[model samples]
Target: MAKDNTTAGIIVRTYMVGALFLLVFYGVIFYNLTLYTEDRNSEKRLQLLSEYYSEKYDLADFDTIQIDPLLTIYGDYSNLPDTLSAQFSESWVGATTFHIDNDEEYSVLAQRIASASGNQTIYFVEAIGSVELDQVDIILFQSMLTGAGIFLFLIAAAYITRSARKIGGPISSLSNQLEASESDFSPINLSGHLPDETKQMLSSVNAYRARIKRALHREQLFTRYISHELRTPLTVIKGSLSVLRKSGNDKTLKHVGLMSTSVAEMEELTQTFLLLAREKLDRDVVAVDEQLVDRLLENFSGLIQRNEVHVTRVLSAPFSLDAHPQLFSAVINNLLKNAINCSLGGKVSIFLSPERIDVIDNGVGLGEKPRGYEGFGIGLKIVNDICDKYGWMFKLEPNPSRGCTATVLLK
Candidate 1:
């Protein structure tokens, strides 16, 4: 971008322009003040010296009088211009000032003072060409300094602009990536290490990307799960129809009831899936169905037997969770798995109340667990995320009696 167009670039350009204006104004004022003031002072000093000489010395003794190097006195002043001589001859003033032009490089200022004797006219001449030459040198020096200042400013401005672009590059790229279609969504990977603020912004962007990815994954999984769940009931209904065809009229009612039960189960599962798959949690109000826990335990029966772990249940009857069943099941599954793994042959306690579920185990506490414990595992992380999504309170802390106790308080 042009230096005068971008935000920082414009600021630098404006400052440089203002500085240049100030420099020019200062140079003009300085040059004029010094030049005119010096000229006036010099003229006054020369006039005083000429008066002293006229009062104290004869015309012949003018050569003995002290004078400035740039000044000279002439008692036999005969080479004046015709017009100037005529003017001075008629004028009755005590002194007259004149500018004399000649072939020499320097201009001369001649002040004529009438001597004590009327016949002699004394001329005081001063060369002022050196002052003009010094003025030129002063202007050149000021110009050079101003140019150097502007050059350095441009370099600094360029560096600042480049740095700003570097800092914003990652964020800009992330924004472009986010603007893509949902199907085209992908992880954002920034190339190099950036400043802390930019890094934080990139982290937030990546977090948002992860959220989108999870939501999409859930969408795909929901579709697959719905199809899979529907197939079981469909197969049951088909098998029952085959049975009805083979059996006599007495068993016809049994086959019909079987088909009806399959249909009812499919409907229930569908409703559950729909509730769990919803994007918003505003309508979530999961009532505790007694069969929900029965199904969960039945599903985990094989794992329970393999682990050879004793289970103690203190669940309140007619309980419910104020959350989607799928999400609640996930949280329970992760916590239960972690509790079982940490139990190490010890008894695992499952205490449930109207508002919360507590899984207490007598295994090594979180502090004593190895580095790769469930604290850093994907399951525990998912459990935490689910709990956070539904505004549930979850804590996996070390129990006062022994190992860790996992608690999930539903809102």
Candidate 2:
């Protein structure tokens, strides 16, 4: 899933987002931990004072006020003022807070140290301002720690960002180089300054490129070999037919001309197949010199008659196209052949417009394209490739009338 998104985006978002969460989590945890430590220390101080004073000042000697270096002991509940009494009543063991002076408060512990004298409430007051000062130091430490963590994180992020770009830069460069090379069908080259990993990747790409070039070389050789081999026989046959046309009777001359035409078309098809393989045509553009609909229908007349299919040609105007006749005819022939093959003695309509040509057939309507039709399928695939090379729009869709429509738009 991460592969679908950009690499840099994922890296930045994941790292930055995770860092923020960690900072927040740690800040809360550290602050609470400091507060907990302060509370525990205060409790310990109160407990020690209570133990020491309990040993020295017995319950029988319950004095109202007993001063010490660390603590000011208050004896008996009734001795405390009304307001102080109310405040002390609310104090807990370790978290006790009460006023020591008008402006200052002390954190202390309340306890009942009893003996045979009677129950007496005593306040073990801690020395003033210690707990408040600790709290101030904790706040300052928390701020400094948070600032330091942020500074460290920023430095780490900068380092990581630089490192990512360094590592990812060459990879991105290699990828772009591969794309450009593939698009132009050229060799890929990487700079010698690249890192070892990048060098390895470039080596792999170059090896793959070599393999493709070799395969293409073989294909071109085979095409040339087959075309030369076939042309020799075709040339001889055409010569023989030309001679026969001159010497034979009128009916024989007609048959010879048809044979000659078929031979020529076959020769053109051989050249077309070669051009398709090379993905380059001799002519970039050609003007329409013949009625395309009439030519195609006449060429496939025999097939139409055999299949008992009705053909209709509807033209808005004399159709104009910017394509070589041979290539255009090949495309039309493949589409027409497929339509005829799929239809069961049904109608095949050829609609010609200023911008497009549509061959629609009331047939099987493209239901599960039948396989094992390689000879015909390859021809159609070549047609599609030609259309793509020429930047023409080709679409095949099922028609509402239980048929399929193949549209070729010249743009």
Candidate 3:
């Protein structure tokens, strides 16, 4: 079952539990108070009857005297009813109420007198039909009280709901404002009627947004500066290499060719970095084909040769992806470079389909190599970031027999 985590739910539940406890508490107290009151009233009436009868009749004449219909007098303790006799057996001082054989309630009192005729015991018993009526009245009173408590509980529950909504309103508004302004880091605006605590929270959120905006501005400036500074050096090197190629001694020409390749790779890296630094990507449709793959492989030819890794490609069909060309190329380049570096003398296989690309390498599997091994860390981070921006799924797992498999789900 799902939990009720909302403010209104918590408030209502708390109020209901408290109200229920109060109702039980009040009911017990009411019932006990009614019973105690009735017991005291019954005892008082028995005491008054005992006093009135003791004055009206003499102890010697107690047996022969006419008894009142509401009262029963026992001149001897042995002549008393079994229920009343059992109560008087313990003491001859107090009054108590009990039921007779006919189930009629009686208030009984026992008195012992020291007289000239010898010691005598007398019992005065009175039937109290009012006790049954009192019981009915108590039931009715409790029922009324319970009904009133239930009504109050419902009112309290409604009040709690309104209170919860009132308490949660500002927070909900703030949340909606944040969601609406997701692409724009503007300060939130809310009604002035908010609580002091909520106002403080709003201030904190706006301050945090300002800090993030400033940090992003700094990052943008830094990336642009780096891109501009590096391009000048790369342009100068390309020009120098071209001049060296024109002069052409065979060894110098070969060296110029290598320098030209390195320069080209450097230019591509600069473009890739600039594209990745942007807050938003250019929505260009770039074709992922054998030509693009071959160009990326050429940039990593030195690594492939040094590692002695044989590379192969299996193209099910040509495909296109919605992404910036430089970003896409960077992703493919990094994944392939990492595979070659890890495979060292083994095979690196690339399987390309419309749906996904799988780069499987028969080399030391993940975790088998030490931390910070070549082709890990920064390379994988770049691939992951690009994949996330493009809304693609990327996974890396150890291969069954030997190396590791990195799969990028394009769809």
Candidate 4:
């Protein structure tokens, strides 16, 4: 369900429960009050009827009102009190006989009063003349009311149960969907429109998916640069060697030299691709020897010489700490290569210290860092990653000269 609807449902159920409780209390109170008020009025009527009968019959001579006379004088006492009493009036008016009802209370009381007919009068009063039916009716009505209250209670319980299920089922479904979605995975299926929190979560999940997609896209482009563009030169190099066999002339040696150069270019491109491809390498932290960095840099000394870049070193004592060696090399090599490229054949300076290796190149200082474009051409990114993973620091800034200095601090 939608957030608004769920909230509304909860609010509605709360109000319903509140109203139901209030109504039940009111009903019970009113029913009891009706019984009490009716009883009180019945008592008053009994007294009044007794007096009326006394005046007519003048029964100081009678102790109880006869059933026939009571019914004739007061038509109904169904809503009256349970018992009645009065004093016998000796100076009462004449009545040769008294009327009576056939009901059990009236019959029993009538017999008692009649048998005691002397100078004494007997007064008898009762609610509904019939003891059994009045009690039975009250019991039955009360039972009906109890049943009604129980039914209403059950109805409220059912509504609450259903509402809880509605909310829980959707929330549980959303939790499962969230668990299934990963950083790279796309398009999580939330079966229906959910509440606000879930919708917000889905939006965030989608955003995360987009970031991964972009990373994957970048990786694809990186792969393409190696496989296709660089592969062409390697293919040309292979063709040149084969052509040398067929030509057997001065052209052969020239083609052989060209082939050698193409082979070198292919090797460099392969290294670059390999470096970029090491995304998940060194997932576990392991010690990396600092000497390894220096050694790796020495491998590129020949390139450094060819480019006329002065490589300076402050020989650092090698210390082993957590790192990914192959991935780390990508960072170093890229930075070194970029520095060399940007040097414009001016002295690309490289400095190695105890804590870090600095690659300084006299060039256009990263040209405003090339917005919306990021890679390891300058090699610092992979270096930065090494620092990030190892909890170290990597810095890149403009050199005092017209160049840029890239620093990678080892942990």
What is the lDDT ranking, best to worst? 3, 2, 1, 4
Tens digit of lDDT per residue, candidate 4, span 375-407?
A: 445345556655675677878888786888888
What is the clash count for each candidate, in the order shown?
A: 1, 0, 0, 24
Rank by TM-score, descending?
2, 3, 4, 1
Evaluate model 3: give its TM-score. 0.64
lDDT of 3: 0.79
Clashing pairs in 1: 288-320
Give the alpha carbon lDDT tens digit for every residue of 98-159 in model 1.
Answer: 44354122222344445555455455655554543364676787788668767876786677
- Which candidate comes out best when scored by lDDT? 3
What C-alpha lDDT does candidate 1 achieve relative to the native structure?
Answer: 0.64
Candidate with more favorable, higher lDDT: 2 or 4: 2
lDDT of each: 0.64, 0.73, 0.79, 0.58
Q: Which wins on TM-score, candidate 1 or candidate 4?
A: 4
For 339-406, candidate 2 gives per-residue lDDT tens digits of 88777589898877768879999887765442333343665686787798779888899988688999
Best by TM-score: 2
Alpha-carbon error at 350 in model 2, in Å? 4.7
Q: What's the lDDT for candidate 2?
A: 0.73
